[model samples]
Target: MDVAEILSHHILDHHWGYSLGGVELPITTHTVTLLSVSVIMLIGLYWISKGGASTLKRLLTAGAEEYVTFIRDGMVLPNMGTEGKSFLPYFCTLFLFILLTNLAGLIPNMKTATSNISVNAALALCSGGLIVYCGLKFHGIIGFLKGFIPSGTPGWLVPLIFPLEVISLIIKVCVLALRLFANMLAGHMVLISLLLMIFIIGQLSAVAGVGAAIPAMGLEIFMTCLELLVAFLQAYVFTLLTAIFAGSVIHTH
Candidate 1:
């Protein structure tokens, strides 16, 4: 295969589906990764429920419990105050879902669902929807929309302010989607390029490239560790931002 095909294979989504009524319902690698994430989460839940006295089981439960508490107190409560408790379930699910999907990319032969732009966009939409829903629930449509306008604005600037605020809200959701999609896509591309370098160099001088591959392999391993940390960090950042946005909409200003 040519370079373009190889790169596309690594970067693009793959579909596995049959045509039905001339409309294909794709079961892409991202779909499989998402399913895997759900199963992994279920397994984590099972481990927590087992309440086993084994060291590994206890450690898993402890970690899960700690993460839940962290998201609750550190993220949800601080941002949403007493009202945040209502969203604990959503916060946990979002964090764990993102975390699992992010980590899944590191596993051999497994794809990253969040790397898909559509998936990231969908996630951002969900968060944006929640923010809007909360705003509308707390304040009627008119009131909720009015919160977008700055207080004490000049009447002459009313038209500009309203449109700007609405645009800002849309931009927030778009930023959330692009930030996540870009990060995941860039990281994977970097990893793939690094590995590909070994072969590219080997094509010219087999001995030199073989020697270089050793250190390259080591760097790749280091990157794997860093990627693992990034997986957690990105998940936390997304969850934190969603909480902040939700809180902002739920309360005026």
Candidate 2:
């Protein structure tokens, strides 16, 4: 059977709920599965990084060093100026977390956190909220509020422009959340569905099925690599966009 068929059967077999602690929740198989995997990966990372110079130590150090340098040189510094240096740790953490989460899904019997809407939404909110917080902190309440008003608008247009600008800002947050959630979710769905095709076709004829399965397997492998790229790209994009918005508020140009 294809991965999608298996997932569909599993979902049908298990009653799902979105709740915890007696409170209703957005209970999804994907969310629970991915979160468990993420926790385990995080623990593994922590354990590997805990000791002095050993093989695991060197591996962890090299991985972290490369990731940190990538985010610092490629993403933050160019966009946010010298002040961006202070944000390096936060960006690096976000990037590694997402990258690990994305890669975990490629493992047999593992789930991807980025494929869950709740997970992606939480990540988006963190980045978006930081943008708002930094904006207010650097610019103060009045300056932050005044940011909505464009430089050359007439007094009469301020009333219309202000609300529109505020709404647009709100839309940016929504788009950020939706973009990540949709991309990750869609990629997984496509891969699973393709696997399912191989299973169904194989049932009809052994040779035909095997032929189809070979290409499908190759495509899945390619997608696994693509997801790795996406994991880092989304992390960098989120942080870079946040810095751009924050910088606009601070510099007001």
lDDT of 2 by residue, 1-253 (tens): 4555576653222326657788877555556565665687678767766756787688777886776787888777777667667767777767667766667666666666676666777877887777777668777889888888989999999999999988887778777777777777777776777777787888999899999988999998898788777777776676677667656655665
Q: What does candidate 1's lDDT look like per residue over 189-250, in tens digits?
A: 88887788888888889997898799889989888888898889889899999999889887
- Each prediction's Cα lDDT score? 0.87, 0.72
Residue 105, candidate 2: how far off, in angstroms?
Answer: 1.6
Top-scoring candidate (lDDT)? 1
Worst 10 residues of 1 by lDDT: 1-10
* Sliding window of 10 residues with minimal summed lDDT for model 2: 9-18
Model 2, global lDDT? 0.72
Q: Local error of candidate 2 at 190, Å?
A: 1.7
Clash number for candidate 2: 5
